[model samples]
Target: MTDERETVEYDSPTGGWGSLRGMVQTALRERPSAGAFETLRRQNKAGGFMCTSCAWGKPKHPHAFEFCENGAKATLWELTRYRCTPEFFAKHSVTELRGWSDHDLEHEGRLTHPMRYDAATDHYLPCEWEEAFAAIGTELKAIDPKSAIFYASGRASLETSYLYALFARLYGHNNLPDSSNMCHETTSVALTELIGSSVGTCVLGDFEHCDAIFFFGQNTGTNSPRFLHPLQKAVERGCKVVTFNPIREKGLIEFISPQNPAQMITGKGTEISCQYLQVRAGGDIAAIMGLCKFVFAEDERRGGTLIDRAFIADHCVGYEEFRAKADATTWDRIEQESGLSRADIEEAGRVYVAAERVIGVYGMGLTQHVHGFENIAMLINLLLMGGHIGREGAGICPVRGHSNVQGQRTVGISEKPELVPLDKLAEQFGFEPPRDTGTTTVDVCEGILDNTVQAFIGLGGNFLRAVPDQGRIEPAWERMRLTVQIATKLNRNHLFNGKTAYLLPCLGRSEEDMQAGGPQTVTIEDSFSHIHGSLGHRTPASEHLKSELAIVAGMAMATLPPNPKVHWKKWTGDYSLVRDLIAETYHEQFHDMNARMFEPGGFYRGNSARERVWKTKTGKAQFTAPEMLAATNVADADGRYRLVTVRSNDQFNTTIYGYSDRLRGIEGTRDVVLMNPQDIKRAGLSAGQRVTLVGDAGDDHVRRIGGLEIIPFDLPDGTIVGYYPELNPLIALHHHDQASKTPASKAVPVRIEA
Candidate 1:
């Protein structure tokens, strides 16, 4: 009865007495005070709703639990009490809910009706929401809408990602695959080819006026723990920070700012990096070409100027092919592929040549890997070799993880190549749209392994445990003849069922949408682009749920077509006419974006690289080169090891909020892996033993996803680490990130066996 792989390993923290007994069993299982102060007075005020966890940037005041601990477990998992009925999916079948665990199918609750997957009683029955939108609009209008894909989920809502990218370009198909193409598509294709905007040109008061921050491959107090109170107030106002990261993240080496009430009443904890380094997980493009080859040899041996040579000769453009590829990258191949030490990249390039102002922050650990867009164009060529692009505390930030996924690729959820958002959605919905370039979560599971993607909808993620060869995303989600989803709670991609699936449910950004013209607010852009306005306060846990803008206007009114071309049921019954079609297709940046999203804390997005004004195409800011490749998970001629995949301060993104990973003192257990006592005596294994990692299991392969333990520590030699979507079946969705396909889930290549 109870053993959905020990149901989210209870309070799972596998180390120091399971993180002090899972923080005294989450403070004696809390409760009583469920009124979460009217959901924290509807977050960022002026209505409310946007904190579905991390993409931080919003507190210009408003504390008292201004959320974090993964935004209060995404606010008690969108204020859960747990639901899921239709007799709990006609009593659990899809082969016993495909052996559970993804925190036991999101702690088995919150989903109420509109289901489908019958496959002759393998269960999940209740259909009828217009018969599961006329059987998903007659099997996606008999396929070939480039075989239908769709996807999305950064917990949608910029009016349901502009009505699911205008109902997947009015069902003709630009596939729309999302979850930011398996996380930060190399920071939106390397900040749109170096500063034409793919987002993050500083904000959050540019981490309180930089003067060196750096941080690549982010671990910001376990992925944005309220960005450790603005990086412990930029290290108590002496600002330096540093960090690189291959693993040394004890919250970037010491951080204890429980929102600094005098360092959480004197248990004191503010010593966040004044230098940490580590490097080597795909050595951030040889540590940004060894910090731009030590800022071009400290501008040729301290000659007074660290190469901003008049902002690279007036705002840049291949400074002579970026100074002949930063003087053809040497420092002994950047200290032999950045394991760091050319006097720690000349002492972090002498603190980025005595910082006048720097920023750099990064994440998706430098964009998932395999030279993630030349490790984000070598951290924008070490912040444009020190002139640090576009002013006010310098630029390039990228720390986004859904809190509006870079405003769903800035209000058009692109797959764009010259489908220029299907020619601005056929000049705002009249027709001729779907120009093609579709499929992308790894080209929709390699277009469902060559049968060419036969209809999958998704809209809210966990798509087969956030894709990347989950045995080829569970048989390309059982060669789907329609797979739907839309969800709120209940996951493992709704038991990966699909010879026709559905699911539906919805409404959670903390409830209360009401609609038919009453209380409805939504916006959300954040990670420093701002935007705001969210509004849900309780109610609607179920009166048969709904609102992801009424199930994307009831699946674009039973899969569009009849009288379509945009009215989509009066723009889903008013979301200020989906912010007046996002203020008439980004009218010089959402004009009055629904009257400045009702004021309070909402609106920012102007950023011409925050004033250095270089929206590229040779207008300025361009220093691009990135062609290094050739480092496939090193150490192998019989030495094995590489691995990487991390994340566990009670996880998020592949949502497992417990079973203890309180800053790497593992608990309950996520199998464990760490390693490095001299690569466990150079792979002769042992320190708790039990191994078996092997690799390349591409499409739904598993062979031996057995138990592991290992531990050791200081990690680097020929590395290893573990933890992502539980070692994403040892990664192999064609080993990703070739110019931003993303999924190199941190380096990979394995062979631990034992």
Candidate 2:
């Protein structure tokens, strides 16, 4: 906790020699097995593995080095030579392993065999695959299906998710929780209500032709580095890239494409954002409403020439109410809540009005709050006013984090029965799927704490580490009757084995999956809804490791009684068979998926809103007119500062590659807090001083993390920034979006203790 704060100023733009050096350092540190780099070379290419870092779409003609620095790190981490075999587990008991850091737990390396927890020895002993499967099936059969939760992470492929969904449904439960529930679930709920589609309508090619793009609450460089390529090109082509974020992210200010040899050699980079507005944490709603208010004022001054009156009359509803709300919202209130001047908001509005085509893009920053749904709804209102919903280069784009999170949702991983086609699944599989709505990510934590959830099946994720209220979830996790984890590497989540827990090793995305039909190619859907095939070129880390598809099949085959319709063995042998079933279930969107997946750059699943086809209840694009405009995160008490959790450059979601945040001029530590200089001064604290952050958890209980060094930066007053998972404990489980249940990680109220 007393880690020294080594502030290393990184003056250069992101993605130049520094990025290249990071990639090289990652490769050297991981010490990957043979052919790892060779497999990485083919990433995002035709017949290549998909990078698991982010869901950024690949260009139609991908560069030779399509993978970014974090992508390379993910590949190397999976393909590393370090192995956590039974012998490794024998050396360290579960109690001792709990004392290890998350990085050390994963750095120990890939799990090589299936292991079962031994309570007497406090160690994980190697177990046969059959024994693990039987034990899981026996426990599952003993408990009511409603008492179990089937959780899927983004790492699972479309085939594996489809099979897993079917298995969970057949097992007579709708308790399916996924990573999306904690991230982009608000996107699904908001977009579906407004535009009748859950996914983004924009394609990767749209960025090239768009005249302007409005980015809200997303860090492009760290979360999705490959996206910098398109942004750099857009800047080169004179497109106005406007950004609204709490932090003055380095990537959005300027970017140098490593692919551009000339710029790299010259040490110069293209300016990314034409204007960057440092909005306060959870101020996106007010900021977007301010833009809408400005647009309405301009349209009135121009005699309605600026607003798309015809499009609104023909294709949208509730405009009159939305306009009334915008007209009632005053400039003084907007400026105060958004932490920006009226002139700045108007200037950004002028940029929007001048552009012929624009794309409204966002990330979890907008979707992980109490008013998450409203935040996105207001953005949709802005886009609808400009007629940006259905156009060649204009639409909504939610840049997802995980590689296959969207694909998993598309393939029927959801807690809402209404979102997925339950009837079709039941009819196709010859069993009635549970129709009742199921538990979400937050609900799962509550269920576990109450001991109502007896068993949990994790497809591929560190569930305990990723979710909020980690301090509460860990002990309850151990009380469960059974826990099954299908993963590739060792993580902190693997150590918390319940009464009966099994760790099943599975193939990574960069490893070969030789089925009975020969080498297999799995499919994943990007943030843009483009479906592409991924085939690993590298060998499997261990001969005993099974494919995720196989592991799900093994659990299902062992649990369920022999059914005439279901063929688990055949489906596991050939993934295409699973895809065919998916085609039948989601016929309109994924019809002929097998054939279309082989097409050039794959194929888009198609968005209804993109074609001006609204499938909402009103049969048109809908608009939400909130009664009032306010900042989602507000100062309820004196000295309470708004805290936003973020990931470092060297880390992905819950996966830490290194301790440094190179882009932010910090090195050798992730425990430092970035605060505004004025705020630090007001709090009677100085830079490099260690402090504790206590959350406003709305109860008598104290939730705090101590020994975090404070580093003064250029952030807004009453706003501080810290790393995620580390700060997750301060965020209460109930502090989340009411509609989506995504934890409000972006805006938690806390006070500093010197």
Top-scoring candidate (TM-score): 2
RMSD in angstroms between candidate 2 and the native structure over all alpha carbons: 1.9
lDDT of model 2 at residue 500? Answer: 94
Q: Where does the lowest 10-residue lDDT sum fall in candidate 2? A: 1-10
Model 2 alpha-carbon drift over 4 Å, by segment: 1-9, 631-634
Query: How badly does each model clash, as a count of residue pairs?
Result: 21, 0
- The lDDT of model 2 is 0.88
Superposed by TM-score, candidate 2 places the C-alpha of residue 559 at a distance from the truth, in angstroms, of 0.5
In candidate 2, list every pair of residues with a backbone clash. Answer: none
Per-residue alpha-carbon lDDT of candidate 2 for residues 1-754, written as tens digits (9 for 90 to 100): 2222332346889999999999888888889999987987888887778888799997779898998989999999999998999999999999999998778888988999999999999999999999999999999999999999999998789999988988888898888889998799999999998999998989999998999999999999899999999888888898999999988888898888888889999999999988999988877888999999988989889898989989999999999988888888888888887898888988999999999898999998899988899889988999999999899889999999999999998888888889888878778878778899888999999999999999999998888988988887888889999999998888888889779999999999889999998888899989988888999878888999999999999999999998898999999888999889989999988999888885556688889899999989999999889754543534456789888999999898888998868998888888878888777777778788889999886766578899998987778777889998788988888889877889989878888888
